[model samples]
Target: MQGRNAGIFRIWKGVTVSQLIDAFERRFYYLRLSITDVCNFRCTYCLPDGYRPQGTRNTGFLTLDEIRRVTRAFAELGTEKVRLTGGEPSLRRDFTEIIAAVRANPAIRTVAVTTNGYRLARGVAAWRDAGLTALNVSVDSLDARQFQAITGQDKFHQVMAGIDAAFEAGFDKVKVNTVLLRDVSDIHLDTFLAWIKPRPLQLRFIELMETGEGNALFRERHVSGELIRQRLEQRGWRCQPRGRTDGPALVFHHEDYRGEIGLIMPYAKDFCASCNRLRVSSMGKLHLCLFGDGGIPLRDLLESDGALEALKTRIAGGLNHKKQTHFLHQGNTGITRNLSYIGG
Candidate 1:
């Protein structure tokens, strides 16, 4: 499938809908929409203290209708790809409906969901029927005990079962996301890769980012992508450049593996220079930067008789103000929002 089209990136600098699509050819018009702030697993890096209020906890989640409206507006502005995320998107009551709504838009070519894979087995087929294009499962560790410890849940088997079911359900591409921690989950990297070798899947290792609730964990345990590649080489895994795609993960193909491995080294190496993503929280806030302090509240505008044209103008303006990069380094003290709220 062709990636997100270029029309999505034409930013209207001013607050006018007429300039939504300028002459610029920005091909990566990908939006990561958070469906909810609640999740089933309380992962160490994501939700530690049981989903406590971070920067703004009282904010309400967008209703299904509201989400559809915003999504439709974005689609009109050339947003060809939309990925539904959440504390866990499956936790949403009408997730299938949401997927269907996104698919109803003719301009949208790809609709993906990134989940913990807890409820995927039961819902993967239904989601596929609803027009989901791909599934990205977050599996940090292959060890059940470590999985429970990392996520604060005992649903490791269920998650694994869900992964298998996704494949059985005919989901064309399945990508496994693994967030690498220095001494915590890094040791199981090779083992996890070995297990997924037979499957037609892409294994991704993400460097831990210092964000809300998990900032402390980031300071304690940090791992770089280079070290991960070296460790894989030590395990007799040979890698080669595997080109680029949507999202900030640098990919590599292993010599004898059935699939590829991706390393997202946001800390050690910053891809924000070419970053082409925008995040809309569950509450309809448009965030230009992942580590940005606040987002423009578009929910109220959309609810208060906001025109689709006006909404497009607002999104364009927000994109123009997008930060070049975020500062999330070791020992750098900065108050940021939680990954759960921003749709990890």
Candidate 2:
């Protein structure tokens, strides 16, 4: 074990691997990997007018091999969960292949995907067969008219059927993401609660975070997730402790309800203290923080399998520079113009 090297500090399956720990002593167990930036639905808070190329030169997304390399490297470093995200991850032609590749890693226990649910009804069974373990579909509203107004799509009923299809496909639970947008989200809170009464859906109300393109709307409609949390508490919903590998949601449970509620409030005090995940853009750049300055390029090391050791070393070394928290409270959205660009 003398040649174990500098970055690596542990051995797994007779191979030297490093733990992805930051200077703040936070260890990462989950990775958010984006495979594409193209999304079909234009969510009002995310990509309002639909996704456009960031600039003139469009450098495509990560290939299957690149995805495999990155996931392998992270798994070696103790990443147990890999969440494939995008403007909509299902948009990729090789999405099932991508899922199988990530799930192929022995160290990775969960292979999750966050999509718009446009393709989930028909394609979810195949995706589940291909090794997708967890699914998060964006359902901004339950009302069809409001859903169209929020997501710029008329596929409300279709997406709902997709959720039903997911359960038929053998998934025990499906997490639904809904961004809390003042009057927009608040108006349908009762409907959301009623819909989850019998199903095992974890309806997560995400606090609207300000991005470069969402500044105007953030001011006009951003609502604190605390408001919902207080109401749930008063209704006899007890707060639940988050698991180590869980996302940044403060989950709550009620004895009478079959489903649970989760609140993701980024602006909450000390919100980043329990951070246990890392993000990589579809273009192969590692984002230490979603709202950080810029990314560290890892694409060069991912070009070939021969650079696997170098890839692991680069990822481990980069963690030393990871900051303690994001600056959303300070009104600095970093280089992210919108959620789709960085796979939010």
Candidate 3:
């Protein structure tokens, strides 16, 4: 009985006997899974044409069971954290069920969801109950008209309500992610900061990257994180460097705010050297780098009743061959999917 209890405890702590063999040597154990390619709102950075791709005879959306199997396999490979991303994760009918399954797995420690916050108002509490630890909502502008203009959807009020609902749902942390463009959302920086000052939520300002379909926009309107910081400093906001986390967001604390701010400088300031994440698209392709084009498709392998140990070997091999840095520096053109397809 004691031995069995110890075994259960070990699994609960993500320290299984099989995990001890390889020692989970991967530098980063974070996994970003795209649950779907469907979204309700067509944000400028996401879907510029306000068009969602439809399924064809050759393409099919991944089922919830398939997602669970892939997630479980990754967990066994020592992925402690899993984030569900999408065209909008909430659009999936079984999103809550998937979250619950991932959370029920003892190997996964953190379960996060990134959304546009459209459905958060009614679904936030249910998602929490289903085992979501944190929520990251994309809100680029505070102005209603500007927000509608950027998202191509006049649902700013719905987004704001979703954010409030997330807070009300007792989420430990809620992050508001904004992609900073040169002259677009940059002007509303102060308004965003002021709004988040009293709340415990964190606001993340992301630099436009060249990986998405909006390559032209990225090249034409790229805004550096340093410039944003400078603008904040001019507003009497002092920033102190915070420690590193899994992703690219560089955190800072403000003097006047109870919350914090994060700068994700993917283009202007690259952190690819310490990059420690692998992205798995909804199609089951394993992407090593955010800027790279190569990915190992695991869907076929899993569907074939392939050996789990062999799958681990493939994952390890993929990580071992991961580029130390992305091709953003050399103008390398190997990338295939955009940020939306890969779930930013």
Candidate 4:
């Protein structure tokens, strides 16, 4: 807690840290932490493209040491996987420092990040060399015009260039995050497949979920994973599940393609039964549920002299409060921040 003292991470509220479990008996080994709420893209589902960020007094955010401290605490609690996110994590000035700190913890076996890929062309080499393990790049559409319409920018070529750079940098496990909007996300299948069929990366089609905006938009445009799989199957595309057990995605490879593809259909297909993750906000709140009502703030504890035990207490309480699944109980009241604030 104080200067990231080594032995300060001995316990999680006076219990074996690894034993931290939820009401469903789920042991969280993965943590998705937002490094910043700032981003550049204005995708319709996230922020309005080029929207000016709101300035705040507490914008000091978490210093590099503070991130390391909190990450260390979770790592001590059996968090083997940590993924950094933000409005765009690449926008962080200390992105590399944060990655370094995450990797420094020997207990953390894998460190990853999700970004818009605008800066990956230049940043990938640096991050890969810094021991960054994996990446999930957001590219809603492959068609230039559709991409511009979705992100309100003509940087489609630039982002694609960044992906090429990532490939050149040689990270093997890069994947794409495509939010399926009705008219916006259906890129020409032939063109899109041609682009990815030869590459080793996986393209994941995500069902659109309502965040700050209401469900009307989502209901109007959301493309179900079942539909995509059906269309592909109709086209004679064969798939076999890869049986991945580590991440949120359930991936499959095309019968004739070298790369793979997957779907994350939170709305259509429920994967909450096997969920094993905890998400921390950029400002130090422990989010028990990504779409839940609220979180427990840990800034005061992290900054105070006698903070470790208190942090453990709050963290344990947060874990206890973790929902069995989000938006599945009686009278569903969807609670989610804007995609940017929660880290797209």
- Clash count per candidate: 0, 0, 0, 1
Quality of model 3 by C-alpha lDDT:
0.74
- Model 2, runs deviating above 4 Å: 1-18
Candidate 2: worst 10 consecutive residues by lDDT? 1-10
TM-score of each: 0.87, 0.95, 0.86, 0.87
Over 1-344, each residue of candidate 4 has an lDDT whose tens digit, in order, gives 11222222345676534444676666677888898888787787877645445456465667787787788778766677889998788888889889998999887888998988889888999998887888889888887888888888788888888888877887766788888788766545566578778888788888787765535666678777777777777866666543212666666666778777677777654568768778888888888777878878888777743566666656766676676687833435345656766554
Instruction: Indicate which candidate wins on lDDT.
Output: 2
lDDT of 4 at 232: 74
lDDT of 4: 0.74
Residue-level error in angstroms, candidate 4, position 119: 1.0
lDDT of 2: 0.89
lDDT of 2 by residue, 1-344 (tens): 22333245577898434567777777788999988889999888999989898787556789999999999999988888999998899999999999999999998989999989999999999999999999998998888998999999999999999999999999999999999989888777788899999999999999999999999999999989989988888899998988777999999999888999999999999999999899999999999988999999999998899999889888888888788889998899999889988788
lDDT (Cα, tens digit) per residue for candidate 3, span 142-240: 889988988888899999998888888897578989988888868777677778888988898998776546778767878788888787677666655
Model 1, runs deviating above 4 Å = 1-27, 53-59, 232-245, 304-306, 330-335
Q: Model-by-model lDDT, in order? A: 0.76, 0.89, 0.74, 0.74
lDDT of 1 by residue, 1-344 (tens): 12322234333663222213322322346789998878878888878767764455565688877887888888877676899998899988799999998899987888999999888989999999999998899988888898899889898999889988988888766999988888766877657777868878888899888775566687788777888878776867655553222777766666677777877887665466656567898878887767776788888667743577678777766655554567676444233556787786
Clashing pairs in 4: 42-49
| Reference-based lDDT, residue 310, model 3 | 65
Q: Judging by TM-score, tell me the better candidate of 2 and 3.
A: 2
Please list the residue runs of candidate 4 whose C-alpha ends up more than 4 Å from where it truly belongs after superposition. 1-19, 49-56, 233-245, 304-306, 328-335
lDDT of 1 at 116: 92
